[model samples]
Target: MQRVRLVDVARDAGVHPATASRALNPAVVGEVSQATVQRVRRSADKLGYVPNTLARGLRTSRSYVAALVIPDITNALFPPIVRGAEQVLTEAGFTLVLTDTNSATEVERSQIASLRAHGVDGFIVATASWHDPLLDELATEGFPTVLVNRRCATSALPFVGGDDQQGVRLCVEHLVGQGHRDIVHLAGPSNTSTGRERADAFRAAMRDHRLSVRQTVIECSAYTEQAGAAGAARLMARRRPFTAVVAANDLVALGAMDALGSAGVTCPRDYSITGFNDLAFMDKLTPALTTVRVPFTEMGAHAARRLLEWIADQPPTATQSMLPVELVVRGTTGAPPVD
Candidate 1:
């Protein structure tokens, strides 16, 4: 069977091959007229024509592929982010290559080097640490890279994510509004921006409400459930009389819940809890989790779009794109119980 080519489609559409190519290419779709674009698309659809991406890449000197590097693929929070970025890249006639580094810095650097060596056009990274030397190096080289959901403190890299400080403030305020004056915080690791920002925000919010920050705050080694449980246990061992717990993220909140249950405590009866990120299934928990919802999908999509702009030699107007957050009140929070 003879394979249909761009020339064949162009002939069927009564236009030159160049015009048809321009019409079909998403990167340059605006260069062609709408009527011509429609005609070429119809002809190509009728002939079941598929674009030769390899040939197009050779002509444009672009692989039209982007790499999205994440820290932990096993986490439930990343799937929505990946899907959102994938959708935007696909529509732009590009492919996404996903890599997970298990939160290892050296492995993440190696993955980026490998992807660059293989000629990937750009990158969207979500594994940046607070002081990432590798990311600084990439920025020094002026690479087309964007940070998503995480960012480096030293690099001038464009980032898209939720406002961690504002989100934590909302959580603290919510718990305080319920008369939880003595609230404990299970903070994530201090090495990452999300952890540090949220932890600092928790401290500031508590101080603003005239609460003791040092006595109620406990730092976790990582953002895992085990770390959360350990933090909670440590807080309890300190003999601090607190009526509420504010976890840095949903997974941490779940861990805190487990720790409290094992100690014969019940949520909203003995204590109330709040979580961040509002991950899936929070509403269906034994006692629905009250959390702050970050726009994960929007963050992913915006990061992809920003990378594309950079790749096209059109830098974004801002270096930081902070998406808004919302507080979701549910069954896990209530007024402090009578002592």
Candidate 2:
């Protein structure tokens, strides 16, 4: 058997071998005419031609691969993001490698180092903290990295996320419109941008509605169910009187609901709760959740596109990309119960 080569495809497509090469290389395919690109691709397919990526990498000094670093693979919030990113990368003739650090900085550092040694072209990272030294370092070293679903406080790296302030404002307005006067907030970790921005936005919204902001924030240690449960427990222990709770994310909301139910408190009857992220199956909960809908899939796709632009030597026009959000009304929220 003989191996198919670029010359064979070029001969069959009636184009030069150089044109065939550009047509096959996604990074430079746009240099050729669309018709020629299609013709070359068809010829390659008919001849069972496969580009030698290893040889191309050696000549171009690029692996044509991007690494997506996330905090947790099992979190329902992340699968949509992964799917969106993979689709864009595959279309661009780039391989998408997914890795998780389990929310550990040390593990993240090690994984990133390993990927760098393997010649990954760029990174789409979703595990940034508000004050991440590693992210700062990456930016200082001129790495082509984009942050997804999270952002650093002062790092120069580009980032894409939902408009946290707008999302919180929508949640607050919805709860207030339903007559939730005394609302408590289950905030995420102060160390992450999502947590800080959402918590701050909640305060601003509450103040706008003439509600006292005192004792409204219960800071959760992480964005997990366990952290949500612990934060709810602490709020209960404080004996605060509130008719509604605004959770930072959907998982936190679920944990809070479980904790409240254990103490014989039911949603909308005794308390109203609103959550962020509007994750999958949120509408199918025992009492369907009212949450802020973030377009996570779009967010992921946008981040990957941004990274590709950087890899192509095109600097982004802006440092941040904030996606819009919507308030999803469900069964979990209602007018405050009679005192």
On lDDT, the leading prediction is: 2
TM-score of each candidate structure, all chains considered together: 0.98, 0.97
Q: Write the per-residue lDDT of candidate 2 for residues 16-47, one digit (tens) a residue.
A: 99999999988888899999999999999999
lDDT of 1 by residue, 202-239 (tens): 99999999988877778898778898889888988998
| Residue 311 Cα positional deviation in candidate 2, in Å, after optimal superposition | 1.1
Cα RMSD of all models vs. native, in order, equals 1.1, 1.2
Q: Going through the candidates in order, what is the number of backbone clashes in each?
A: 0, 0
Report the error of model 1 at residue 256, Å: 0.9
lDDT score, candidate 2 = 0.92
